[model samples]
Target chain A: MSLASLAPLVDAAAVGDPQEGVPLALYLAVSGGLFLLGLLGVLTRRNPLLLFLAVELLLNSANLALVGFSRYWNVTDGHVFALVVMVVAAAEVVIGLGLVVAVFRQRLALDVDQMSSMKG
Target chain B: MGERIVFTIAAASALSFGTLVVTLKEPFRATVALIGTLLSVAVLFLLLAAPFVAAIQVIVYAGAIVVLFLFVIAYLGERPIVEIGDRLGRYQAFAWLAVIGLAIQGFVVLATTQLPGVRDDPKQVGDIGSPEAIGRSFIDDYIVAFEATSLALLVAAVGAVMLAKRAVKSEGGR
Candidate 1:
């Protein structure tokens, strides 16, 4: 779903009574904010390693939102998706870090701006 | 009362640490904040009654993933800190403005909307998040996706090893 549709759902979730349980809106807000922060980091940062961390944050933010929705709907689907995403993220990191290591070893340039060989 | 209090604390800490992970100058410090952010999210998962997910969040994310990052940080020793001057271009200004606008919009939506019973009944969701239930669904409903994930992971492991070895050989040859 588009982020616009999610806005009211988040607001609606947040406005509910809290004594019964944690509100879905609060979870959504936190996850959304975290996701945005990670995006900003990815756009602004130069360090490849830091970029990796930012990407992790982005994935985790998505996972959090998924679990929240799963709980809201009372389904197991979100949990499974989160689990699979976790595996995918782990694999991505392994390969990405390996590439980073290899490149650093070759020329010791850690900044993204410096690695322009692929820019065509 | 306790749930609200815990949720407030966890949410606040998680957001702050998440921001730190993004804005910190030193990569190592950012890594630490990232750990804190993950741990706080784990607490939120626990509060949400998904104990299994919370445990995995700790073991895989806080433990394995962050440690892997630390290993990379150690390998790339003494990298220059991100310079703050002479780099903020026009796009950077627009990006910051966009972030602020989004935050304001989120605040407005959160403050204005009201939906009762948005979450499921506590009784209904109780078993759904448990490890046994999740595992059952994994085997029964998501078997194909699960199998694909395993295959992908194996390939990634092999690829990572090969890539690193090739890089080492090339460097040596040079």
Candidate 2:
């Protein structure tokens, strides 16, 4: 098959409803996948910094879905919600990084497994 | 067609960078990858007709928060210890499965709830992209939230300085 012939198939796989000029399903799927990846990272990674990044990814994935849905519904509420989410996310990152700094200073490490003193 | 192409590129780049953010072993590389993800997300925001929010995403998240993350990673230096063990157990597997199932069920419920005659409308792309519009709306409609956010930022700044100071003082004492 010619490369040009295969192009449509590839595009179709990545996006649905070309006539609509938007790929709602693809956006939703990718956002959900990103969220799952972040969730797995949080569950599996030992590094606190990586965990923090993963948490941010999870938040961003939700934000993407919110914006996508808002566009699909033709409403401004989704955009407003996304803005609020970003504000909350910023606050979260500040506090989270601060905590990481405090923990590292005390123990000289970022390993989540080693910080088990508070597990009791 | 141009819009579709832009959406495809933005979505692909965002997903790829997001994956790299988690998979990269070096904290610094992962932080850089996260910045890429944020930039891609900002592009997505613009494509969605939210130029104002997209600008804020770039300025606040990509510009400030990510720089802070990089600084933290750099300041910590290289600790010999790295990987932590898996925190999840078998119960977590079931928990995740249940959550996914519930999410799918909820989506089905919502999809079914749409009115029979409802039709998708073309987005009314507003003049909301202008700084004037955003400023006016923010001041008039969201003034309380905006002021609260400023206060929160103030508290965060003070708290961050205090946290860093304590660390410095303790190190000096030792």
Candidate 3:
């Protein structure tokens, strides 16, 4: 009934023999490193388009971690979640770029800091 | 042997190009670096035995998304807004230090945690990430969520079109 009770069944499919597949820590390191790069980019970059790219990097890093854990646990959930995230990303980009195009059509300032027109 | 080598190359390339994507000032070059990062990550997916995800990653991410970025960049023709000589500020230094600290904490966690089966059974995860399994999940337990995603996508499509469209009538008919 509960998730803890399902541990045995879940572990049956998990990365049974760790000697064969890649090390889990290595994957985690790479994913975390990429995520940091993305965070740094988002923090430091001013260009909105560059910011979008950094966001993509962040999403990809999350995906990598999901897949790694999926393989480690031998489950389908992570794959499905990552796939759904990918689709969400596609939809996000469409709207984001559309908004950018519409706004830039009026006044083409590409800086993220310059878009704060909703002042109180 | 082969597996470790491939993983190293893939990880190295993924990080390298990812760094380039964040750091590069040129829009065109940054986009290309992002493509490289996507491709490398896809390869890593393949190595992780998610062949279906790897293929989709290539097809959807590298093939479609990056190309869409390229098209938008080309059409906009607006130069990257990052200026020379004054790019890095105190804010950037603070960000760098904060991220490095976060990275160190994360690395510590990764080093200490124990996996369920480490060097024990030595069995491979077979076909879990295959299309069949994923499709079953989409239709079975995740059916509602999957259908909701489709509806959201439809709305997003229409919304994107509406947002990008100019009001010619309001502007006295262009």
Candidate 4:
């Protein structure tokens, strides 16, 4: 495409204002990057606590995307769903930490691969 | 332009603090970083025009959840961590490669889209994400799901108690 046709796309990236709100794709980029970083942590970090923290990151990324879409569409549905996600995340952390405590007590080891009683 | 600057700062902090959450080895340090990321995301929510959600994000996610993490960290205390071989296991190269690929793809999509043009005029659209709107939805459109979340939280609390207690009881039996 000619630069004449692509000017709008370039403008869209820079048209940041409170009244206009942020572009949806920029939020998506942030969310995607956050998700990737969390994925890296989950894959690489064997510590269950750290793994849970990474999972939190992953969930937060999802929330950010949901809110962005909600704003883009000018609706509250995305906000509601984001709240649901927050609740689920809290529950997940609670249960996860409980399991971590239980498992860590059984053995002082921290690496999750070693806790493969059910098999890794 | 003021909003844009704040959004830029919030987004940057969210990403950087998120990186710290993953990279920090100590649980407490990672959790502190996680709070920074969460608050930044909360500011992002405000910029998105969801003030109610932004408040809840801070009160519930940052305040409640991070406190839970802190309590767990305190209860568990610190322990020496042994190095696991290969770090990220056998797929280290593949994982980093995936990260790079996704980054490039996301950047391309973001660069090409005329997304800002699609955004509605906030003044004409009215308050779509106000507390009243969201509260109405929770009761009218999503009552069942909202109730289900409460049930799920209750179940999770009971299950955690049972699971954590079972471990100690089994240890006593031994």
Each prediction's whole-model lDDT (CA) = 0.82, 0.73, 0.79, 0.83
Question: Per-residue error at B24 for model 4, in Å?
Answer: 1.3
Pick by DockQ: 2 or 3, better one: 3
Model 2 per-residue lDDT tens digits across residues B1-174:
567678778878888998898789999999999998899888888877778778888998899889989998888777555444455454567656754775575345434433322123234655644557657766777878778877887887788788878877777853
* lDDT (C-alpha) at residue B158 in model 4: 99
Candidate 1 chain A worst ten-residue window by lDDT: A9-18
TM-score of 1: 0.86
Per residue, candidate 3 scores C-alpha lDDT tens digits across B1-174 of 467668779999999999999999977789999999999999999888788889999999998888888888887785444343433465678998989899878856654455655323325776788899999988988998898889889999999877755633233455
State the DockQ, from 0 to 1, for candidate 1.
0.41
* Residue B90 of model 2, lDDT score: 47
Q: Who wins the TM-score comparison? A: 4
- Which lDDT value does model 1 have at B140? 99
> Model 4 clash tally?
0
What is the alpha-carbon RMSD of candidate 2 to the true structure?
5.7
Clashing residue pairs in candidate 3 are A16-B122, A17-B121, A17-B122, A17-B123
TM-score of chain B of each: 0.84, 0.81, 0.85, 0.86
Q: Model 2: runs farther than 4 Å from truth?
A: A1-20, A23-25, A73-75, B82-122
lDDT of 2 by residue, A1-120 (tens): 232432443456554545545545556665776787677667666678899899888888888888777667665556666777788788878878887888876765677777778887
Once fitted onto the true fold, the runs of candidate 4 whose alpha carbons sit more than 4 angstroms away are A1-20, B79-88, B113-124
lDDT (10s digit) by residue, model 1, range B1-174: 567668778888998998999889888899999999999999988877678999999999899988998988887877544444334355677777777887788766655555555432343466778999999999999999999999999999999989987987887763
Q: List the candidates ranked by lDDT, beginning with the highest.
A: 4, 1, 3, 2
The two-chain DockQ for each candidate, comma-separated, is 0.41, 0.29, 0.32, 0.54
Every candidate's fraction of true contacts kept comes to: 0.51, 0.36, 0.52, 0.64
How many clashes show up in model 1? Answer: 0
TM-score of predicted chain B, candidate 3 = 0.85
TM-score of model 4 relative to the true fold? 0.88
